[model samples]
Target chain A: MSDGARERILAKVRAALADVPRGEEPEDVVVTRGYVRAHTGGELIGLLVDRLTDYRAVVHRVPAAEVAEAVAQALKRRGVRRIVVPPDLPTRWTAASSVVAVADEALAVAELDGVDGVVTGCALAVAETGTIVLDAGVAQGRRAISLVPDYHLCVVRADQVVGDVPDAVALLDPGRPLTWISGPSATSDIELDRVEGVHGPRTLEVVIAE
Target chain B: MSGTFVGMPAFPEAASAATQNAQLRHNLRKATHTIRGKRAAVVSELDDWAELRAAGKAIKDRTLRHLDVYLEQLEEAVTAAGGHVHWAADAAEANAIVTRLVRATGETEVVKVKSMATQEIELNEALAEAGITAYETDLAELIVQLGEDRPSHILVPAIHRNRAEIREIFNRTMAEWGVPAPANLSDEPRALAEAARVHLRDKFLNAKVAVSGANFAVAETGTLVVLESEGNGRMCLTLPETLISVVGIEKLVPTWQDLEVFMQLLPRSSTGERMNPYTSTWTGSTPGDGPGDFHLVLLDNGRTDVLADEVGRQSLRCIRCSACLNICPVYERAGGHAYGSVYPGPIGAILTPQLRGTSSELDASLPYASSLCGACYEVCPVAIDIPEVLVHLRGKVVEGKGTTVERVAMGAAGWVLGDEKRLGLAQRAAGKARGLVPKRHLPGPGAAWTDTRDIPDIPEESFRDWWAGRGRGQQR
Candidate 1:
């Protein structure tokens, strides 16, 4: 059955293109890819911080040595009791926080949903669009861990921030499951009015570690 | 709507009522203008928008040109990634394949993302007949489903409904659908979204089967990309155990590099955002992350027929962004229901006739729905020359099977105007009968035209007669 439908569709397509010249190929089409890759000149980290804040995501900027303190303060402000983290995340980042850190491995979805928030590192962040790329890499757990909870607190190092979408795409591996998140979940469906916090995390806190 | 689009009235007949609806007109005007302003602001931020638009058009064109080759490549990649691929020639086959797939999993209920491809096939209605329920998870689609209404716009299906109307729908219908609304829910967008979140949480957690449509399918990598603002799509894509995606054959891009161009073009042209909140990409059945069983159904309902026509083939490049709908003057006044298809607005005018053929009154009248304005062309990300295709389809309608009263009248006019003496005699006859003509209304075949327009009074003397008497004296 599959072969029959497949052959018929391909045959119809072949018959439709009978008028084209034999020598013409898909590569013959000249598509100029001259669009700018990165718009920010040199203030990518600053732009990333600014754009994320514009999305109503809480932004924390601090030196590398103060990363733990920043996470602790963000968790304290939200009054989160328990947080989920990927196993590979640096132990020191959550060492200062008072909340219990639960590893994502073998945790049921219902258990993850019970947690107040999830904190982990990102694959990279785009400055112009204010998006974090998660490939289920070392510190980033499966897509569900970051999605199910009510709050998400992500950490982005200064070196992992890119200036634009193309640069971010170049750095990530597509073979792995990838999720690009710009801000907390939002919906503009109601008469085209944007309302944040639908199904995913309602509150997003980003810490830019220099 | 007569429940569905079948046997619907012509465009002018349907639009007459919609134009008189001041509330709908006001709602559409406000919503479209807001989005239009936002789209323009974000689009101008990119310095090379024109180049990006050009690349988007070129990539789609090249992909369509070599579709057979790329489709085979896509099928191989998807199968190699442990996802099953199915081929469907038309809507019926596609629906049957999906229904059977759902039954194979022994599940009666499935959660759905807002997919136009499934809506085109009326899959939910089909599943209803088979004793299965399909829950619409998108906030807009949920409004449409609960209200029992047709989707008027592509992006926001409930564009015609205001906050008050949505609040009433939720209060009246939410309890019947599994979760009830909060007591005395306020008419605010945030409160309504939260109500939906509470109502759909259990369904998402318990759903074993999920179905969707994709924005772009990377042929080389077998990855399907779905970009959405709300996280409902992520829930439907990730939480379920079995994922079935029904996509049109034209959604393929040759490579991930080709996908980069569309990733930039789509979000800005669509929600007028720098980037949407959520973008999910999965190659196939990921062992532990997303759904373990993935099925990709490629649909080809009348697409090959569209591709055969050289002039009509460009309509296939549409990315369903609804930018044309937001920018259209006719759409703002007449609204989207008049088009009578899953696709609507200016793209609908050209695309519906090509996909469904100009057989029904609604389909035949779509090409003439537009004012031949080029605003849709200017904003189209894929650069579909919509006005050009509309004119081309108009010609096809006139030359095809059925004959209309207007065609006969045009034929008579052509015959008389072919010769100078016949034209002069006809003009003189009309001149003599000028007083008998009605100024406001015509009696017979011209009533449809004159119902909404005025008829010009005929002059006492023909222009030929006035010129003929003066020319001989000047020659002497």
Candidate 2:
């Protein structure tokens, strides 16, 4: 965080690059393309939809004004009675949900696990390849909130969706804790067969609030 | 250097055992496919990924080209930052350095962040052999260690186990290590994670020594970087009194600016995130903050040998993002164990043969593990042409043999095809004998090729005969 520390880190980076042989010059990563037609928030939501679907995740979309209603509806659909909300998530996001709201503050492992779904916002979304990135900050809770729950409902806005990887990288601060999710957690064993929901969320729902 | 898996049969033999294990195959397929899909989606998000990949490859290749210079610079930087740098030419020397360092701390136990270098050197096994216990702090790694299994995936080492299986391993084996698993552990993912957390908490709190592998070592300031998804890496990196890092010499990038490229490339490629959840960086020993004593062991086991070859040297560019492993079709099937090394999948195929040399049967067989599909290349964050290396290594294997049957057969064919008159005679004779040529190949050494493939029958007439009958062979 200090200026001196930043400078020292940069100095080391320059030294590391000194001897790197210059070859075919690298091309700049471009982030703009009009492949999928959606608004910025719509595009972000679409990426979450496509990627989660590819990863076999369930997706939901809601209007910006009715986000709380959507969350409540989603929980009811999944038969979830209690939900974990990060300490910093907007109060309005869960207003419509009659389910018990559990704050993520020093809660015991048993208590956290009792909750069904956790709702949070992502740090960034990349469109070129549909991915949702989370940094352990205010809107996005601690690492465990998204990780521990079996069902995860993440909110993403259109402006947060970047067109490509470079654009997404530019938006991230290296000092923060970041989590990138394309879809729900899944794995492929030796035979190239797929299995979903191993470590992270088994049922991932992205609520793209346009 | 004789680790647990040493004396293991060649890849084909090991693969035969792995391929038949349906459970293992299922687990591997599920893990690799999920990660591969995430990696693909994240990677495609970047239009300049090709450029970034090239840049990553260029940086590593450039670092390896003048490795001696960069290594010296790194040592100087580390020393200036209050850390001691020890160079180890081989695994034995490296292990000795680490063991001595830990022993100096007078600690019998050490907590560890997952590191491939340590695994490659069998450092934990060696330390255990030395009567010092090393606790794996990473969740997946802990599952593997407790279960007494080798890691099957690079990023997620416990990709071979399902949740239920992991719960079983934890419940069955946690007490023997340190803390005991909860009396009633459920297969629920959260409960399983809690069990591991409760089990590992004591190790973190009490550890006197910590061992780590660095993702990037900056030469300018002598800082070491470890990026992880879990907070366990942060705990191990910060809590210990003495910290020891066993890093490959190739892990260095001369400056933090260079690190920016890898930082961008690694997280996106490995976990499909824009950044890792935990990116811990330390410069030497930070007084009153983290580890008081820091020792850096620079390892160069067979890396220089790999660097000697112009084509193979590019392997040093790998960032160990595991993107190649996730996407590799062969890796998805045969799994990591078949590679017979800590590093597995496409990177393992090329790196193992080069590092260990093709002298051993396992090392020799590794180069042929891939189907040369080029998928690994397509997904590589550093753009390693794995197929090219595999083909190149295959050539090396052929050249290594003094007189293989294929060589003998090819030699005889060369003699027959050497002269125009001899070629004409052979073709005429073959034409006369066309009906006798079998539809399928005859049984013998060549049978392996025909067993799974249809052998092409010889043409009814030689092109020369057809040309001669058309009245143009001799005149032309």
Candidate 3:
């Protein structure tokens, strides 16, 4: 059944593209080089830190060997007692944590809102903009886990980091569910005064696992 | 669509009434602010958000460029999947097609999801005129229908009303539709939601015909996507015996790959969520799982005109995220009703004029409704340069009018500037006439410009005369 539906939809797509000028695909849009030279992972991390802080997200870094310890320490520092763990989370990342662990499961809105914090791995990170991408497939669990929690600790692998917006788009799959995060949720009032965390997490913590 | 706003007053008159309502302004401000904050917070979580936004924009632009092909492919796919497709050139055609479809189904009542396209064509009113009753099953839409009101916001159609006003509307109007409001109804959010649920439950289960609009139609598989915060869309798409969708041609995406990008952008941009609660997708129909008979109405209704313009074509990239509306300063002040159309805010200001043409005073005035602050441009997910389009349309309106007074004024100013002697003489004459000039304005047409501004006073000496007195060598 799914195959038939997919085939039918594809036929329509082919017809639609037939009339579109066979120009270069958008991926071919030329990108001009910036004056600043591309940096090593360490320098990129620093740039991410500066941009994230500028956007009001708290950023932290730890050696890969101490990932579990770092996660425990950050949760303890924030006074979080219960942590929501994505279904496909790496067991070693949370082995040293003492907080009560709740498996990320699909729950009603009210039930999900009861969790204190959520910890998950991001699909990719943009060093230039300090953004994180979540595919909500494995490491990220359901989309609601990162959303309903008051605090979110997103673990980013240095290798997963990209330099710019276009580069990141090339890596993302359009069919799967994807979530993009820049900082903690925020808004500005009529007086132009900024407020944080209206619906999503009030606090965002980036755990850059080296 | 044939149901376009034909005789509406100029935007200034409509906006004047909207701006005067302090209570309405307060409600709109509070609601929009809350949603805006929520959206921003959720959006910031993804470091790759800008990339996703750009990707979404690229996909939409590409699809629109080849919309004719994609639409044809979609029609073929739908037909292959056992659905019928109809082409609607305008609202009248769309309404007539839908009425005939319903008549063929032999059903007098149809359940509808909250579809902006349907509202744009005034499908319900048209259906009523044809002796068919189309029920709006979405909770917010039901409230609006019960009260006989227009939708003020894209996502939250009833954002203009408070809970108390909703309670009153439900109590007074629900009975006439089908179900009666509870005997003792309260203004609490939960209570209101429960009342709407109970009222719509019977209609959803009983209706044989269902009508809807697609969020994104994947040309790859002839699949139509509908995302909603409420699950009503799910019921309408599945439970009905016959499902009919009236979708704008621009809603098509070339493939499922393109659909993925919008799925990411739309939910986050619209309701400020990583994912919406209900995402209902269907292609034609299945034997027993969903509606067995399906009809797809591909609507042109001014979209082709919108596609012809180079600079304005980007307006078609809109995902209907409502982010532009949330961020617009002008929309915050004057409210949606001031736009006098189904679409309201920055998108509405540009899209409506193009769709309906700037023939009416209301359509012409919409281009000038903004302060041109560019907030809408900044927040738009698809990157529509709303301010650029507004100025472009303003030029069109001015050129279209060909007013003798304006032409004469420009011609006279050009003559004076073209001749050095006449320019110098006019400048010196203006200096001498300064005392006679009014401090604020010149009255009549100029009064509007000076109403909220001050005109500068002329100096005692013109630059040329001052330079002449200093002598050629002393000019430095």
> Highest lDDT among the candidates is held by which one?
1
For every prediction, compared with the true complex, DockQ reads 0.72, 0.06, 0.05
Report the lDDT tens digits of candidate 3 across residue range B1-476.
12344466777787788889998888888877877886898788665667766776777776776665677788888888788888777788889889999999899999998899999999999999899998987766777787777777777777788778889988998888878899899976656666776687668656789999989887877878887644467567766789899999889888765654665678678877555544555666655446788998877777777777767778888889898888888888788778888899999999999889988888989899888999898778778899999998888888857668778888999999999999999999999999998998778666777887898879999888888978766664
Question: Which regions of candidate 2 fall more than 4 Å away from where they truly are?
Answer: A1-210, B1-3, B400-405, B463-476
CAPRI rating of model 3: incorrect
The candidate that wins on DockQ is 1
TM-score of 3: 0.71
Q: Candidate 3 residues A1-210, lDDT tens each? A: 122433443344444345445775534533222212222335777777776776678888788888888888888899888888887899888888888888855554455557789999988887755677776655878655676566889898878887644466567654444456767654321112233443346688888888
Candidate lDDT scores, in order, read 0.90, 0.74, 0.75
| TM-score-based ranking | 1, 2, 3
For this target, which candidate reaches the highest TM-score against the unseen true structure? 1
When 2 and 3 are scored with DockQ, the better candidate is 2
lDDT of 2 by residue, B69-114 (tens): 6777888888887888887777888888898888888899999998
